[model samples]
Target: MEIYQAFLVALVACFGKFTGDIGYFMFDRPIVLVPLTGLMLGDLQQGLLLGAELELVFLGIVSIGGATPADVNMGSVLASAFAISMGAGTDVALALAFPIGVLLQMVKMLIYFFRATTMHKVEEYAEKAEFDKITFMHFGHCAIYVSVYGIIAFCSLVFGADAIRSIVEAIPQVVMDGLQATSNMLPAVGFALLLNMLWDKKLAILLLFGFVLSSYLQLPVLAVSIIALTIGLIMIAQDRSSSKTAVQTTGEINEEEDFFNA
Candidate 1:
């Protein structure tokens, strides 16, 4: 990639990273980030497909409190950038994404550790009733995050892309094939993880229904989704109707009791 292209890619990465710091706009998601990176890299279609694949790969991974999950946004951004720039396929992107994400996670942890020190200053400002200073510290930290990670991404693209390409080229075809197989299975694993977290016997039927539609009927995803949505709306309406009937019955019983007492 050219320097300007790399710079633009870095900007995309920074935007992804900064999404959380600003608010939960969810621009950091691989589904969003990879396509933007791809657009910057001049391969929107490839980026879109890769983004969807990467989204599945990172689907169940989430950050909770101090436990930071892998940096999916950064990883996806770089992976798509590399893939598009090299005219490579999803296999290479998948092979590179996890390590890149983990590396960025480490960087995030370090950044958070150092950024924690600013809390002391924030507390001091809070005590002094210096609201402006406290606010500055908050936004200033966000700015720092953007600048630091943006530079890291910029450097990675300009410096590491060639090195990575060389390494990938040196790998044996058998290993590349193995990576491709692993990549193909990752979406299933991601879904499994999601199901493990959200497993409910009552809802399992719905899951099976969707599965049957997709697998046996060979229905498209949109059709299955619409069917599910219709079912959900019907269920919700039934529940509301039941509640309303119960309320009416209770009201009638109360009126009867009052009439008898009078």
Candidate 2:
């Protein structure tokens, strides 16, 4: 890869690394990151295709409460760079994604740990009322993160492209097929995680209902979604109405008892 291309990708990774929490620009998402990488490398479609696939794979792997689930954004950056550089199609890119994200997640976890150690310093600054020092430290933290990923991104471009291509080529045909198969299964695993965290039996029944409506009746997804939204709104309305009626009924009962007592 050209030096400029590598630098551009590192720049993208830098933006993507902190954009999730800091920038809130949505570039940290694979949907945006992949296309940006592809655009950087003059292969926008390649990036988009890869992005769409990775987006599904990591769909539910959101970071919450300072948890680093996986650095899937970094995976998107690396996988797209390697794929575009080596002309490895999206399937092969998908195969590499999870592993790459896992590796980058380690890096992210380490940063989070080290950053947590700086809380004492932040506390000291707060006690001293040194607000400027706090701002300085925050910027320093950002710079360190950007530089860490930027270096990784640059070096990957500088030295990792041929290695990744060779690794892809060295794998057996069956293994490659297996990788692709596993890649397809990732979305299912992601959904399973979603269910584990946010599952409700009632919602599961609703989900099954949607599945049946689509599969059996051949209803369009948008139509089914609209129906679901309408049902949800109606449920909310009914709950409010029921609560109000109970309140009114209790008020009438108390009024009747007071009249009898009087």
Candidate 3:
């Protein structure tokens, strides 16, 4: 790509990723933004694949209590673009992306730490109940965050891509093998995290049903999802029926007591 084109691409990619990051924070998802980045880069297929894999890897990852998790947006955008640009496979891209994502997370944590320092001013404003000052503080903090992201994006475009490609090309076969090995192991990590979220005893039967359907019956995910939806509807109907019966029984008991009192 020409220097001007590269700059344009970088700016657009950065803005797309930034938008995605904001969406992730609000909607708790990064998948929506990855495809947009890919589309901007003229590689929608690679973008979709990268997004899906990243989503799986971070399936159980959540930001709770102001904690930062891995920066999925940066990871997906950088890795997907690099992968498509370099003609690398999905697995290789994923292998490279995971660590980069974690590094981005660290960067984000540092940003958050700086933002925290500014929060004291907001707190002081709150003490005076100056709502406008509190609002300005929030806006100022967000502007700083977005500006930092834009700078990173611009710098990465200007200096990072060629260097990254050179490094990947120069990597030894042994190291490449190690990356592949790590890539293979990453899905297990993702699954383990998902298991943590879905370990409920009450949902054990449904889980088993899905497992059996997928593993033994070899059903497609679409088929399994449909079955699960049907099961959910049935269960909901049964619960409603039971609730109605309970209400009727309670009403009869109340009537009986009233009649006896009369």
Top lDDT hit:
1
Model 3 segments beyond 4 Å from truth? 1-30, 65-67, 233-262
lDDT of 3: 0.72
TM-score of each: 0.89, 0.77, 0.77
- Candidate 3 lDDT over residue span 1-262, tens digit each: 3455345545554565455445644332436555655676677887677677666666777767877777766666667666777777666677666677798778778878998877878878889999998877776766677667667756765678788888888888788888767766776787789888768898888988899999999999899999999999999999999999999999999999999999
Candidate 2's residue-wise lDDT over 25-117, tens digit each? 767989889889999999998888888778777778887886767678898889878988888776687767778889988887788688889
- The stretch of ten residues in a row with the least summed lDDT in candidate 3 is 21-30
All candidates' lDDT scores?
0.89, 0.85, 0.72
Sorting all predicted structures by lDDT, with the top scorer first, yields 1, 2, 3
lDDT of 2 at 146: 78
Off by over 4 Å in 2: 23-27, 64-68, 213-262
| TM-score of model number 1 | 0.89
Better of 1 and 3 by TM-score: 1
Tell me the alpha-carbon RMSD of every candidate. 2.8, 4.0, 3.7
Clashes of 1: 0
User: Candidate 2 clashing pairs?
Assistant: none
